[model samples]
Every structure is written in C-alpha cells, then in structure tokens.
Target: MDNDCMNNIEDRKIIYQLINFAIKHKKIMQNYLDETGVYQAQHRLLMEIFHNQNASQNHIVKSMDVSAATIAVSLKKLEKGGYIKKEMDEVDNRLNKITITEKGKKVVEQSKQIFDSVDGRVFEGFTEEEKLTLFLLLQKLNDNLNSMEDELKSKKERK
Candidate 1:
C-alpha cells in the first residue's frame, strides 16, 4: 500500500478507538447515574444551578449550548425532585431564577465522589508518568478538535 493510504488507515483506527472509548465511558457514567437516581441531564442541570445559584433558565441554555426546551424539561424534573427551587426574578418577573436546594448540594458532593472513584478505577494500572502522558495527549487532541471547529466557523462566516 502507498504511504498516504497507509496513513489514512492508521488514522481511521485511531478515530475508531476514540469513538469506542467515548461510548463505553458514557455507558459507565449512565449506569452510575441510574444507580444514584440522578439522570445525567438532571445531574448536569442541578450542578449548574448549584454553582451558579439564582441562574436563569435562559442563561443555562446559553452556557450549555442546548435548546431552551431541553433545559426547561430538565429543570422541571430537577425541581420536581426537590433538587432545585425556581422563583420569579424580582426585577424581571417574566424569568424564573433557579437555585439548587440543600438536597441538590448533597447530590453534587456525592457525584464528585462517584466521578473520582471512576477515574481511580479507570487509571488503576497506569503509573503517574503514564497518566500524565495520556492527559497531555488527550489535551492536544482536544485542542486540535477545537481549532478545526473554529476554522469551520470562520469559513462559513466568510461565505
């Protein structure tokens, strides 16, 4: 096989591995979330509110880059579960200010422990140097993907 063809095949194999890794990681996370009774979407929304206390739904939609309807649904579920409380904005009565409840704070702390445990297990056999090297490589890959996205946006804007 030619050099270019060989390179393309190697690239494909790397991408396939990356995709599989993401899927498996997501599955494991979902399973953990299920056992904790914290759906992924609700967990994310709860955490956002927990950190940003009194955040508006619109602000969360923008920060998360998700549709308002999607955020609304998740917020509703979170509120119903007593994980969050929504009050009308004092100045802007049309908007609801979201705040994480005490229960939500506990959940956030629990989630952190769960994530740390998962990371420990995932990197159990790796040495410190190996872990650092893997982190650096993953960061480089993330930066490349961000650059490509920016380039695509620039091209589209130019058109």
Candidate 2:
C-alpha cells in the first residue's frame, strides 16, 4: 500500500510506524544533544535568537507551540549559561526581547555544521530529489497532524 494510504489504516499500524520513526529519530537527536552538551530546545532558542536578536518572549512562545512558562524556563537556563540575554523593550515594559551573545553565536555556528552533518548522514544514499520528496511529505504530515489537534481537543471536551 502507498505511504499516505497507510496513514488511513485500521488499528493505526501506520501510527505505530510513525511512532517508531519518532522514537528512533529522538534517540538520534538525543545522541547529538549529549555530544553537544545541551538539550535541543536550548539549541533551538539560541538559533532563533541568532537569527532574530529582537525576538520577543511571546514570539518564542508562539513559534515553539509551547507554554510561556516553558519558554521562560528555557530562556532563564540559556541566560544563566551566558548563551543569551533578555532586554526589556523600550516601547513596552511588558515585552522582553532576546539576543544571542557572541559566545552563543559561535555555538550556533558550530551546531549548524553538526546538524548539517547529521542530516546528511540521516539522508545518506537518498538522491536530492528523493530528499525533497521526503521533505515535502513530512511537511504535509506535519500540517495534517497540527490540524487534528483542534479536533482532538473538541473530542476531549465531548468526553
């Protein structure tokens, strides 16, 4: 059966396959994190700040699709690590902006290379077109998953 068709299957055998992929990939990423001396969420925040020094806490909260408290914890951890700094926005006392320090920028640069290598290794043997196809497919899968979240919430309300 085709891959997408399998996703519509009974007993969710396809869901189990997706879980295996997630588990295996999480293990791979955990290995990378262990070698890198920090967690993935911290790494992501640094990367985001590297690209946008003016990033706001609310922006990170929304982008990460996580709680503001969770982002605050990560932000505080990064701040304590000297990887980033938070400055209050001049226009709004309620809004704070994040910026990556020079050290943080260096770490981000190094992590980018590491992640690139990881991706290359993960997709090794796949042709460039195949890689693009996989990328598009995953993008669609992610969109579908996100769309289901609201449906799941509504079902829980009914329950």
Candidate 3:
C-alpha cells in the first residue's frame, strides 16, 4: 500500500496515529520545559504575558483555552517565582493586568531558543513548501475539530 493512501484509511487508524503523535510530541515538549524551570502551562502563560502585557486574567483564560482556575493557579505560581507580576488596572480596579518581570524575560529568551531548536530538529529535512502545506493541513484539522466542539456544545446547551 502507498504511504499516501494510508492517510485515507477509514477504519479510525488515522485517529490512532494522531493520538500516538500527540503523546510523543508531549514528551518532547516536556523535555524542553524541563530546561526552563517552568511547567508547561506556566511557560505558555509567561509567553502570553510577554507578548501582551495588557492582558487580563479573562483574556488569558480565553487565549489559553484553559479554565479560569487553571490560569489563576499558574499566575499565582508565576508571581511567586518572580516571573510575572499582576497589577491592578488603572482604569478598572476590578481587573488586573499581567506583566512579565525581567527574570521572566530571561526565561522567555532561553525558552525561545530551546523551542526554536526543537522546531528546527522536527522539520530538519522538510522544504519550505512542505512546511507550508503541513501548516495548512493542520489548520484545517483544527477548524474541523473546533466546529465539532461547537456543535456538541450547542447540543448540550439545548438539553
């Protein structure tokens, strides 16, 4: 059987392959996180704040696709580690704006290098066209999943 044809299998083998790849990818990502002295969610949280210092907890919750409680816990941990600081919004006392500390900036730099190396290694042999095609396919996969999730949520809310 042609390797390309294997992707067309309709017996759910593709799902299994995707699941296996996710597991392996998580392991590799964990190794990168191990060097950063931050947990997976914490690293993401830091990067989000680094990119958008004006981000509020609500914004983080939506952007990270994580529960509000998860963001709170991660924020608390990051604050304790001196990697981030949350200050009351000047315009709105009820909301807090997140900011990355100088220490967090250093962590971001190190984590960037590590992740860049990981990406380089992962796509070592791929040409530029292959990379674009892979990204496009992945985006389509994500769109399909998101649509399914929205449908499920709507159905659940109706019951």
lDDT of 1: 0.89
Write candidate 2's Cα lDDT for 69-88 as tens digits.
98899999989988888999
lDDT of candidate 3 over 15-131, digit per residue (tens): 787799889888998887788899988998899999988799999899889999989999999999999989999999999999999999999999899888888988999999999
Best by lDDT: 3
TM-score of each: 0.87, 0.75, 0.83
Compare candidates 2 and 3 on lDDT and give the better one. 3
- Compare candidates 1 and 2 on TM-score and give the better one: 1
Poorly placed runs, candidate 3 (over 4 Å): 1-11
Models sorted by TM-score, best on top: 1, 3, 2
What is the alpha-carbon lDDT of model 2 when measured against the actual structure? Answer: 0.83
Superior by lDDT: candidate 1 or candidate 3: 3
Extract clashing residue pairs from model 1: none
Error of 1 at 77 (Å): 1.2
Residue 72 miss distance in model 1 (angstroms): 0.8
Cα TM-score of candidate 2: 0.75
